[model samples]
Target: MRRAAASVTIVTILLLLTGCWDRLPLRDLQMIDVIGIDQDEKEQGVTVDLIVTSLKGAGKGQGEPIAERTTLKGPSVIEAVGKTEYMDQGPFLAVNTRAFLMSESFASDKPVEEFKFLLHAPYTSINTPVIVYAGKMVELVNNKSSNRQAPIEKLHNFIKSLNSNGVINNISMHEFISSADEPLEDYPLPVVRYHESKFQIEGAMLFHSGRYAGKQITNEQLRMLMFMLGVDQGRQRITGSVSDSKSGLQDITYGFSVKNVRRSVHTQKGTDRLPMVTIRVRLNINVFDIGDNIDTLKPNYAVVMEKLLGKQFEQEAAGMIRTAQQANCDVLGIGKHIKAFHPKLWKSLDWRKDYPNITIAPKFDIQILNTDGFEQFQ
Candidate 1:
């Protein structure tokens, strides 16, 4: 009799169980892949744009995903997102947002301020990657993928290739928050531009105290910057063409593929007791796309190539350091290094004012590994 009563109670419990009470069915939702925010100065408010992807088929078979776009305007970011409820197909699902962009004017002035909604919104993912769009917001939003693929998919692939591409670095939500919290380290974000109707990463956007001040570095310039940071190392270490004052862009000449780089930072006190930073860059390279009238296999030719490439790399690397310093951007985290290892030196001088005048000596030691001598047989 007890067993029968227990069985009856178990059946009653099982009958009362229900699944996914609050779950929203996928078919009823629209997925947003990209979110772009811009300032409407005329309206004195923020304008938000989103790219929503919708599948045409209703479970019969999969149909090609189509992009449905919507724009919302309000006095603030949160209000702008709230205004989306009145748009067709209802509000978008933030779960699919792959990339987020903000206008230069918005990000340059106060980036952390713009991220307030994401922080307070309990459901938003903290890992979502954010980028600053450097061009006109309208021009960027008007862009449809040139290759016929969705812009969201292209951006996703582009970010995945960042480490290998070497030209730029990605700034995710986590990176932004970390950099914002660190007072010494400046923020580094990938700058995007709509060029030739396609999205291209221009370079890194440097921000000091949340102000951009309209400064940017080019891709070639960023390569040297990353080299000195010693973070990229073997990946994306190839520098194309040595430029000359008279002619320009020596792509016909030898191109270098850098590998196995080692970097060290040293400091010394000058006569004025100011700190001096010396950067030593060591790398092995392969010579490819050899120019005409030059033989790489010859011992003398090899020496000349090494000297020429090393000197060129040194000059460019030094220029990159200066560029960063002139803008008062410490992308190298040199100040942090000084604080940790040379605390007295770091505290003695105002780094912001002295950074531009600091003596930064960059030395490049390059070794050529392959001469491509057997190319004729291959």
Candidate 2:
């Protein structure tokens, strides 16, 4: 009798359970893939473009997925998004957004207010890639790949490759949103240009205090910055002349694939009453290429190559540091490190006012781990 009563009670409890009470069917929702934000030609209002993708059959298996383009304009981002309710399908879903593309001008002029909506929205994903493009937001969103893949998909793959190769540190929505409020740390957005039905990542735009600093760095410089910032060491490659040829005809240029890197930042108060920072980087690399000439190899070649590469890297790092200082971009997060480790020093100085004036020195130590001359063939 007790077992029968217990079974009956369990059945009653299961009957009262409510599962997904407010869930909406997929057929009733609009799925957005990419969102583009930009300012109007007059620079007085916001324009939003969305690439909405939805299956035509709605699970009936009748046709291919369809992509619809929609544009909305308003004086602000929130208003533009709100306009969707009146003009388009109800309850839009953006959880699958692959990326957010913003115009250069829009990113430069007061972007914090424009970005607030995305941060507060419940449907948006924080991991979406945020990029700054050179051309019209509409054009970029409407572009189609020759291979029939979505242009935004192609762009996302390109960014992913750059991140995996350690070429550039891809910035996500959460990073961009948080950096705006972080006083010491800044962020970078990969710049894209669409031409001839192709999207190419040109360089990167540096942001300081949530605003574009009117400064851009070349793609080559971006790679060095990635190492300086101590991103994950992927299959990174660097090329430089390690030594001159035996005939003295020209410099022997070689390519090196970085295997490991150890970087450290030291902060001190200089005798001149200024903040001093020293960045030391140690790299372990393998010789990736040695050209057609095998006669260039000599006794103690690895040691000589290490010294030459280290010197060359130090010079390049110094120039990169200067560029960041000049642009007032603390992309290396030196100020953040000082704040965390040296709170007293951080309290005594205004980082924004003194960052450009601070003295920063970069040092590099390169070690060639494998120069067996077989890498060229491999």
Best by lDDT: 2
1-378 per-residue lDDT for model 1 (tens digits):
999999999987886774445555567656666788898999998888877776666476656677767788888877778765575655434424667888878887676766655765633555777788877777755776422274557666766676456555566765575556666757567777767655677877777645563567777667777777776432443635554444343543665555567789999998786788888877776665445333447655565667667788888888777777878987777788888999889889888888778888888887766654513211
The model with the greatest TM-score is 2
- Work out candidate 1's RMSD over C-alphas: 4.7
| Candidate 1 vs. true structure, TM-score | 0.81
Query: Candidate 2's residue-wise lDDT over 255-294, tens digit each?
Result: 8777777889999898775688988887877676544334
The runs of at least 3 residues in candidate 1 whose Cα sits more than 4 Å from the true structure, single-residue gaps closed, are: 1-30, 54-64, 85-96, 145-148, 237-240, 243-252, 292-296, 372-378
lDDT (C-alpha, whole model) for all candidates? 0.69, 0.74
Angstrom error of the Cα, residue 223, model 1: value is 0.8
